[model samples]
Target: MDENRKIIQVLIAICSLFFIIVGYLTYIQLFRSRDFMANTYNRRQYKIEENTSRGNIYDRNGVLLAYSKLEGEEQERIYPYGALYSQVIGYSSKVYGKSQIEAAYNNELLGIDDLSQVFGMVSGSNYPTRKGNNLYLTIDHKLQALGGELLNGRKGAVVAMDPKTGEILALVSSPNFDPGAKKLEENWQSMVESEDAPFLCRAAQGLYAPGSTFKILITAAAIENGMENEVFEDNGSIIIDEREIRNSESKAYGKIDLKKALALSSNVVYAHLGTELGMGSFMDITNRTGFEKEIPFDIPMSKSRFPYESMDKTDLAEAAIGQGKVLVTPLHMAMITSGVANGGIMMEPVLVKSIAHAEGKSNKELKADKLGRIMESDVAEKIRVMMQEVVASGTGHNAAIKGISVAGKTGTAENELSVKKKAKEHSWFVGFAPAEDPKIAVAVIVEYGGSGSEAAVPIAKRIMSQYLSQ
Candidate 1:
C-alpha cells in the first residue's frame, strides 16, 4: 500500500509540472512572440502604417513643408522642397527608415498615444483616429528657400535663430537629397547607396573646427573671467608639454588691445587666455552655452560635446582656435551666438512650433523653454561691443550690412584630414543684428571655401539683411 501511494504522488507532481510548463509556453508564444515580431517588422513596415499618420510639417507662416497624401489606397509622404529641408526634416522610408525631425516627432505625428482625434473619410463615413496630427515649425519657408538659394551648390549648412525665442527660422543643409525622388523604386537604391550620402543631414551631424569664429567664445570667457587686459602675453606660443604651437599663418599681433586681438582673431592671445582659464572654465562656459548638451526640440538634434579629456598644451592650443579635440556642429555654433544675443540667457532651440489633428484641434504646442543663463547681461554687452568692432574693422568686415548693427566673427579652418578631394578648408560665420536688443542670430558654414571672409560672410550678410528688413 505504501509503494502504490508513492507512485500516485509521483504521477501528480509530474502532471503539475507539465501543466505549469505548458501555461508559461502559451504566454510566451501568444504575448512575447507578437511583441518581438512587431519590433522586428517595425523597421520595414510598422512605423508608419500602424501607429499614426506621420505628422504634417509646416513652416512658421503655416506653409506646408512636409505631408502625407493618400492616393489609390496608398499613403505617400512628400516634401515639396525636397533637398532644401532634408536635414531639418529628415526623410522617412522603409530602407533608410526615419531620422532627424521625422524620428523626433514620430510619436505625435503618427498618433501613438496622442490624445487628439483625427477625422478621416472612411468607407463613405467619417472615422476618428487618435493619431495623425500636423506639426507647425518655427522655420520660415521663404527664409529657408532663400538660404538654399544662397548656398548655391556649396557644401555646407546655414542656421538662423530668433535670439528671443530660440526659434530656428532657417535650417539649410547643402547637397540635399530629394525625398520625392526617393519615392521612385529605381531611384531609391541609387540615392541611398551614393557616395555623397545625401541621406546624411549635415547641419546637425557634421562637426568641424570653427577656426576664428571660436574667438567669440574665447573672448567672452576672457571678459567674464576678468582677464581682459591688452597687456597680457604668453611666449607667443605656449609649449605647455612637448608640443610646438604657432599662431595662424604663424604671425602674431604684438601687445595689441583685447578688442584688436579679437578683430584679427589673434590665435596667440586666445590660446593664452584659454590656458589661464583652464579646462574647468572652458567646460563651465560650454555647459552654460548649451554646447555640452542636447537640444530639447521636436526634431532630432545631435548633442554638442566638447572633448576635454587628455588635454595637453598642444591640444589645448589647437582647441583654442576651434581645432584639435574640440569640434562643434553648425547648430551648436548658432546656439552659442544665440545665447550671446539673448542677453546671456540660453533658450531651448526648437524646430517645430506646434501640433494639431486633422479636425483642427490643438494637440501638442511647442513652447520655447529656457535652458539656462550662460553669462551675465553685462558680460554679453561687453562681448557685443567687441563683436561689433569685429565687423567694423576686423576679419568679419565682409559680413557688414548697411544701417544695421552687424556683429560677427569669421573663421577659416584647414581640413587636411577631410576625406573630400582638394582637402578644402572650412569657412564659418556667427553673428546677430542690431547688436543692441538683437532679434536674429545666424551661423553659416561653407566647406572647403578657402577663407571665411571670401566664402561664408556674404551669405550671412544676405540672411541678416533679409531678417532686418522683415
Candidate 2:
C-alpha cells in the first residue's frame, strides 16, 4: 500500500507539471506573443518552428521582398533586397524574433486562421502545407529603394503616402541592419548599441520637436478659425506673456499678411498668433487633426502629442511654432500633410494591400477608410496656397520638383536637450506634390541634420521625383 501511494504521488506531480507548462504556452500564444516564430522557450517548439512554413512577402508590384525556403529539415528565410525593406517588411527569424508586418499578421501567414486548413491537418491530410500564404504590401519597391538611397548614411527617416488613397508608398529609416546577413546576432548587437538606433522605426516611433514645419498646423488653425485675412507685421520679434520670440535669425519683414508670414515662416507672427488664438481654440483644431491620439494603422504607431494642459501663455506661444513640448513622429507629420492634401479628410493609413492563400483561393483586398474630416475645405485650400508659396519662393524652395507645383514647409528643429547639443539640429520638410490634384504627401526628418532645405528637402525632392515620375 505504501509503494502504491508513492506511485500515485509521482503521477500527480507529473500531471501538475504538464498543466503548468501548457498554461504558460497558452498565455504566450494567445496573449503575450502571436505565432510560434518568436517563442523559443522550449527545444521541441524551436525544432517545430525551424521546420514550419511561412508566407511570402512582396511589394505592390509583386517584387519579392521576403520568402521562405526548405533546406533539408530546417527552414531558411530569404530577403532578396537585403537592407532596403529591412524595417518595413521586417524579418521572420528564429534567432531575432519578429517585428512590423511579420509579427503583426503572423497567423495569416501560418494558415492557422483558415478553418479549412486546420481541419485538413486534423483529418489525416496526406499533402503538406509548407508554403502558407502570401502578403502583398502597398509599398512600391522602386520608391522604397529611392527612399533608402536618399537617406544614404544620414540618421533620419522618410515617409510617403498617397493623399487620396492613404496608401503608404514608401517608408525608410536610416542606420539599418540586414537581418539576412551572416553573423546576424553580432550585427543586431552592434545595431542595438549604435547611437542612431537602427532598430527604431524612425518614421513611426522616433519623436522629435517639429520646428517650423509645425507652422503649417498653426496656419491651418488660424485659417479655420476665421483668421485668414488677419494681417500682422514682423518686426523681427514679438513679446508674448513677457517672453520675447524672434523670427528665424531675427531678420523679419516690416509688414506682411498671413500668407506672407507662413511663406516666410515668421516665428514672431506665429508666436503672436498662438497667444491670440489661445489654448481653447488650439486644442479644438489640433484634436480634430488627430493630435495626442493613437493613429490607427496596419502596424504599430506611436502617438503624436500636443501638450495643452498646464501650458502657460509662453508655453502656448512656443507650441504654436512646433516647439516647446510639441512632439511628433515622421509618420504623424506625413498624415497631417496627407490630410491637407485630401481636402481636410484624414484617411486611415494602410500598408498591407492584400493577402493571398497558397491554396489558390481568392485574394483578400483591404479597402481605404476615412478616419475623419479634420479641417474645413476652404481652410485647407487657403493653407495650401500658403504652403505652395513656401516651396515656390520661400524656405522650402529646395523641395520644389521641376514643373510639379509642390507645396511644402521647411523646419530647422532646435535640439537643445541632447547631450551633444552642437552635433546638429533635426531638419524637417512636409509637403504634397501636384498641388492642383494632390497625389503624394511626404515627410522627411534628418536627425542632427542642418537646415530643412539642406538636409531634408533634397531627400524629399528625390523621393517625389521618383514616385511622381513613375
Candidate 3:
C-alpha cells in the first residue's frame, strides 16, 4: 500500500513540471517574441535580412533615398544620394548595427507583422520574402541638397521648417559620410576617429551657445511679465556684480525700448533686462520653450540645457544674452523662431510624412501636432515686428530678401576652440520670411564662422529664398 502511494506522488510531481515548462514556453511565444526579434545583438535579424527585402526610403516628392537589392542570395542596402541624407536615413549593417530612422522604425521597415511572426514561431516556417513598408519623409530633396551645398563641407548645420505646421523642410549637417562608401568597413575606424565627427548629427544633436538669438525668448519673458515698454540706457556696456558686459564694438545706444534693443542686438540692454527679469522668470520661459527637456523628434535629439539651479546677478546677466551655460540645438532654435512666426503656438517637429505598405496601400500618414503656446498672440506679434526691424535696418541686414519682408536676428556666440589660439565666434541666424504671413523659418549656425552678418545670415537668406521661390 505504501509503495503504491509513493508511485502516485511521483507521477503528480512529473505532471506539474511538464505543465510549468509548457506555460513558460507559451508566454515567451506570445509576449517576449517581439523583444527578442528587435534586439540588435540578436542573430535572428541577419536571418530576417536574408529572407525579407527591406523597405525603400523616399523624399517628399518620391525621390528614392535608400533601397535594398538582392546580390546573389544576399541583400545589399543602397543610398542613392550618398552623404546628402546620411545623418537622417542612417545605415543598417550587420557588423556595425543601425542608427537614426533605420533603428527607430526597424520593425516597420522589416515588415514583421505580429500575426505572421506568431505563425512563423508556432509553425517553424521560413520568414516571408515580402518587401517592407515604404517611408516618405517630409524632407525636400532640393532644399536638402541646397543646404548641404551652402555648408560646403564646413562644420555646421542648417534647419528649415514650415512655421505653422512644423514640417521640417531641410535638415543638413555638414562633414557627412557616405553610408554606402566602398570599403566602408575599412574606413569606419578613421571616420569614427576624425575630429570633424562625420557621425554627429549637428542639426539635432549639436548644442551651442545661442548668443543673441536667445534674446527672443528673453524679450518674450519681459513682455509676459509686463516690462515690454520698459526703457534702458545702453552705453555699450553694463556692470553686473562688477562684471562688465559690452555690445559688439562697444557701440552705445541712448535710452531705448525693448523693440530697438533687440533690433540693435544690444548686449548691455539685454544683460540689464536679464538681471531685472530674475532667474525664476527666465527659467519659466525657457521651460515653456522646450529647454532642459528632451524634445520629441522622429530621431534622437539632445536636450537644450539651461541652468536649473539658482543663479547670481552676473550669471543671470550673461544667461539673458544667450551666454553663460545656456545651450540650444539648431533645430530647437528653428522651432522657437517658428513658434513666434506661428503666433506663439509652437508645433511639434515632424520628419516622416507617410508610410506605404509593400502591397501599395497607404498604412499611416503623420500630421501636424501642437507642442504648446509659448506666449500670448499679441506678444508674439510685437516680437514679430521687432524681428522685421532687425532685417530692415538692424544687424541682420544681410538676410534681407528681394521683394520679401524678412524677419530675423543675428548671433555671434563666443566659443573656445583651443587654449593657445583666439577662437572665431560661432555665427548664428534665426528668421522667417514674409513676416506678416510666414511660410518658411530657418536657423543656421556656422562653427568658427565669425560674424552672424557674414556667415550665418547669408546662408539663412539663401535657404529661405530657395524654399519660398518654389
Candidate 4:
C-alpha cells in the first residue's frame, strides 16, 4: 500500500510539470515571439534574409537612395548616393546587423508577415521569391544634397522641415561614412574607433547648447507671462551670484524692450528676464515645448535637455540666456522653429511618407501628427515679429533673402570642454521663410564654428531659398 501510494504521488507530479511546460511554451509563442525575432543578435533574421529579397528606399521624388542586388549568389545592399544618406538610411549588414530606418522597418523590408514568420519557423519552409516592401521617405533629395554639400567636411548638422505638414525635407550630418564601401568590413573597425564618430547622427542624436536660438523659446515664455512689453537695462553685462554675464563682445544696448533685446541677442537682458520670470514659469514653458522629454521621431533621437527642478538663480539666469544646463538637438530646434511657423502648433515630424509592397500596392500612407499648441497664436506672432527684426536689422542680417521675408535667431553657444580647456562656440541658426506664411523651417549648427551669424545663418538661408523656390 505504501509503495502504491508513492507511485501515485510521482505520477501526479509528472502530470503537473508537463502542463506547466506546455503553458509556458504557449505564452512564449504568443507573446514573446516578436521580441525574439526582432532581436539583433537573433540568428532567425539571417534565416529570413536567406529567402527574402530586401526592398529599396526612395526619397519623396522617387530618387533611389538604397537597394539590394544579387551578385553571383550573394546579395549586396547598395547605397547609390553613398555617404550622403548614410546616417539617415543607415546600413543593413548580415555581419554588423542593421540600424536607423533599416532596423526600424526590418520586418517590413524582409516581407515577413506574422503568419509567414510563424509558418517558416514551424515548417522550415523555403521561400526564395519573397520580396520586401519598399519605403518612401519624406526627404527631398535635392535639399538633402544641398544640405550635405553645405555641411560637408564640418562636424555639425542641418535639419529642414515643412512647418505645416511636419514632413522632414532634408536632414544632413557631416563627417559621414559610406556604408556601401567595398572595404566596409575592413574599414569598419577604424571608422567605429575614429574620433569623428561618422555613425552618429548629429541632426537627431547630437546635443549642443542652442545659444541665442533658444531665445525664441525664452521670448515666447516672456509673452506668455505677460512680460512682452517689459523694458530692461542692458549695459553689456549684469552681475548674478557674483558672476558677470556679458553680451556678445560686451557691447551694451542700454534700455531695450523684448523685441530689441531678442534682435540684439543680448545675454544681459535675457538673463535679467530669466530671473524675473522665475523658475516655475521657466519650467512650465520648457515642459510644454518638449524639453527633457522624448520627441517622437521615425529614427532614434536624444531628448533635448532642460533642468527638471529649480536650481540657483545664477543657473536659471544662465539657462535663460541659452547657456548653462540647456542643450538641444538640431532636429528638435527645427521642430521648435516649425512650431512658431505653424501658428504655435508643434507638429510631430514624419520620415517614412509611405510604404509599398513589391507589387507596387500601397501598404500605408503617413499623415501629419500634431503635438498640440505650445503657445497662443498671438504669442507666436509676437515672437515671429521679433525674429523678423533679428534677420532684418540684427545679428541674423546675413540670413535675409532678397524678395523673401525671413524670421530667424542666431546662437553662438559656449563649448567649454573643462574648467581650463575652452573650445570655440557652436554656431546655430533657427528660422523660417516668408514669415507670414512659412513653408519651411530650418535649424543649422556648426561645431566649433564661431558666430551664428557668420557660420550658421547663410547655410540656413540657402536651404530656405532652395526649398521655397521649389
Candidate 5:
C-alpha cells in the first residue's frame, strides 16, 4: 500500500512538471516576447511630429532618394516625391506611422537608441527621439530613376544588382503611385481601395512565372549533373513520352550542340535535358541556388517555389523550358544572375550599405554573405560560355553592350492563368555586364510585354550605360 502511494505521488509530480513546462513555453513563445519588445501605447504617445524633418535617404554616391519638408506655418512634414521611394523609404505620416526602411531603421533614425544626453539643448527632453538616421543605400539613384522611366505606366518590375558584391542598384515597379497624388486625391478612400495596389512594391513583392529565363537555372543543372560527352543535338523537335516538344516559333535547327541549344533558347532540347536529369535532379539544382526557401535579407522578399510531385511527360518537357509550375520574383532572378556571375556562388542580396549612429558615427557596415556555391567551377564556366553565346549570336543579341562583353538570356513566358486564350506573355531578361569580370547583374520582367529582347533588353542597356558611366 505504501509503495502504491509513492508511485501515485511520483506520477502527480511528473504531471505537474509537464504542465508547468508547457505553460512556460507557451508564455515565452506567444506573450512574453511581445510584451518586452513591443510597447504600442508608448510608441503612439511619443510619435515623431510631422513638422520635424524625417531623416533623409541617400544612395551610395550621396544622391537623395527621399527627403521631408515642413509645411508653411504648420510644422507638418510633406513628401515631395511621394511614391517615388515609398517602398525603400516608407511613408512617415502621422496617420500611417512608418514602413520599409522607415520602420526597419526607426530606432537609429529617431535616436531612440541614444537616450537624450544632459548637455543636449533644445526642449531638453530625456528620451529625445532624435531625428531619423540618415541612410546611405547601395542603390544607384541614376539607375533606379532610369529603370523607373523604362517601366513607366506598365505593370511589372525591374531589379539590378552588382553581381560581384551583391549590391542592389535599381529596384523599380510600375503602376507606381505619385506619392504626392495620394494626398490630393479627395477620394483617397477609393484610391487606396483600387485593385492596382500601388502601395505595394511589385519589384520586391510580386511573384510571377519566370518563363524561359528559368532555363538558365536548368542549363546550370544539366551541366552540373554530367554532360561530358552528351550533346543536345537540335533537330528542331524532341519527342518525350510520345509528346512532341518544338522550339519557339517551331523553328528548325539541324544537329546543333547543347551550347547552341541554350543560345537559341530551345524548348525541345531542354525538355530532353530535363527528362534526362529527372525531377529529383532539377530540385537538387534549385535547392543549391536558394530556391524553395526563404533567404535572409533586410528587405521583405518573396520565396521561390517549385511544387510538383510527378508531372505529365509533356509538362516535364515544358517545365524544363521554364514554362510550367515555376514562379519567381525579380529579386530572385537577380540572385540567379549573380550566381552565374560570381562563379556559381550565390551571395545574399544587400540593400543597406551601413548603419550610422545618432552622434554622426557609423555603426556596423553590412557585408555580403555567401549563401552557398551552386555548381562546380567547371560547370559554371560551361554555363557562362553558353550565356555569352546567347548574347553574341542568339536571341539575346539585343543585350550586347560594346566593350563590355555582356552575357544574357531572354524569356517570353506565357501566362498559364489565361491558358485557353492566346496567352499574354511576360517579357524577361537576366544578364550581367562586363561578363569577363561581372560588375552588374540585372533582371527585368514586363507583364503582357511582347518579347523579352524587344521589351526588356533596352531598359537594361540604359541602366548598364548609366552605371558604367558613373
Candidate 6:
C-alpha cells in the first residue's frame, strides 16, 4: 500500500509541473511576444539588420538631415545638421536607445512595420526585407535655424506651425546637444544631471504653467457659452471661496469688455468668467480645445494636462488664468494658437510629410486632418480682434511689427514653488501674423525670463516675420 501511494504522489507532482510549464509559456505568448520580436539587443540578428540599411531623412526643402551608411559591414547612423536640429532629428545608436524622431519614426525607417506594403514587392512576395523608407519632414530648415538662434543661451522653447494646414514649420529647444558626438555614451550620466537638461526636447516635452496665455482659451470659452457681449468690472483681482486671483501687475481696469479685458490680461475678469461658466462648463471647453487628448504628430509629445479632481470655485478661478496645477508643452500651446488663428478649426499637427521607398512605392503626402473645432467662426473673429488689440496697444505692444497686423497674447506665469521665494516669472507669448491671412502661429516660453513683452514677444516677432517674409 505504501509503495502504491508513493508512485501516485510522484505522478501527481509530474502532472502539476507540466501544467506550470504550459502556464508560463502562455503568459509569455500573450503579453511579451511583441517586445521580444522587436528587441534591438539581439546580437544574432544585428548582422542581418545591418545588411538592411536604414533610410535617409530630409526636411521639407529636401535637405538631408539624417542618413545611414555602411561601416565595416555594420550600419552607421549619421546626422548632418548637428545640434541645431538635434531634438527633432535624434540619434539612433546601436549602443544607446533612440529618442524623439528617431524612435518615433523607427519602424518606418527600418521598413519592418510596412507589412501591408510587403505585397508590393517585385515578385508580389516579400522574400527579404528591403531598405527602410526615407522620410520627408514638414520642417523648414531655415525657420528651425532662426528659432534655435533666437532661443540660444536661454532655457526655453519655440514652436511655429502653419495654422491652416497643421504643418510644423519650426520646432526648437535651447541648450541642445550634438547627436553625432562620440562622448554621448561617456557623458550620458552628466548630461541627464545637467541643470539645463540639454538632451530634453523642451518644445514638445517640457511642461510649464501657461499664465495669461490661457486667457485666450478662457475668453473663447466665455463667448461660446453666451457670454461674448458680457461685461465685467476688474479691480485688479477677484476672490473665489476666499482665494484671491490677481492680475500680472495688480492694476485695475475699472470697467471692461471681453476684448479690453483680454488686451489688459485681467486675471480677475477671466477668473469671474470661469466661475460663471463653472467647473463643468469650463472642463467641456477644455476638452473641446484639445486639452487631455493625444496630439497626433510625427514625433511623440507630452499632452497638455488639466487636472479635474477635487473641483471647487477657487480651482476654477485659478485655472481660468492658467494657474493652479495647469501645465502645457510649448507644442500644445502652439496648436491652441493655431486653432484660434485658423478660424476655430484645429488641425492635427503634422511633421512627417512623406515616406520614400526604393520599391517604387513612394508613400502619399500627409493629408491635413481636422482635430475638432474649438469655437464658432464668429467667436474666433472676436478673439482675433482682441488679440490684435493686445499687440496694438496692450501688454503685447512690443510684438507689433510695421506693415503687419499681429494678433497675440502675453503671459507672465509665476512659479508655484517660487511664489514664496519671490523668484522670477516665466515669460510667454502666443501669436499669429497678418491677422487677416494668418500664415503662422507661434508659441514662445522663456524660463524665469521676466515679462512676456520683453522676453518672449521679441522671439515670436522674429519667428513670425521670418515665416511671413518667406
* Best TM-score among the predictions, by candidate number: 4
lDDT of each: 0.76, 0.82, 0.89, 0.89, 0.74, 0.83
Residues 394-464 of candidate 5: C-alpha lDDT, one tens digit per residue: 99998888878888899888785446556567889998878888888899988888678878888877777
Question: Model 6 residue 316 lDDT?
Answer: 83
Better of 4 and 5 by TM-score: 4
TM-score of 2: 0.87
Clashing pairs in 4: none
**TM-score-best of 1 and 3:** 3
Once all C-alphas are superposed, what RMSD does model 6 give against the true structure? 5.5
Give the number of colliding residue pairs in candidate 3.
0
> Between 1 and 5, whose TM-score is larger?
5
RMSD of 1: 5.6
Q: TM-score for each prediction?
A: 0.82, 0.87, 0.91, 0.93, 0.85, 0.86
TM-score of 1: 0.82
> Which 10 successive residues of model 1 have the least lDDT summed?
114-123
Error at 398, model 4, angstroms: 1.1
Candidate number with the higher TM-score (5 or 6)? 6
Q: What lDDT does candidate 2 reach at residue 238?
A: 87
Q: Give per-residue CA lDDT, model 6, range 19-52, as digits (tens).
A: 9999998886678644543566744234435546
**Model 3 off-target regions past 4 Å?**
1-36, 120-128, 418-421
lDDT of 1 at 399: 83
Which regions of candidate 2 are displaced past 4 Å? 1-52, 114-128, 359-362, 417-421
What global local distance difference test value does model 3 have?
Answer: 0.89
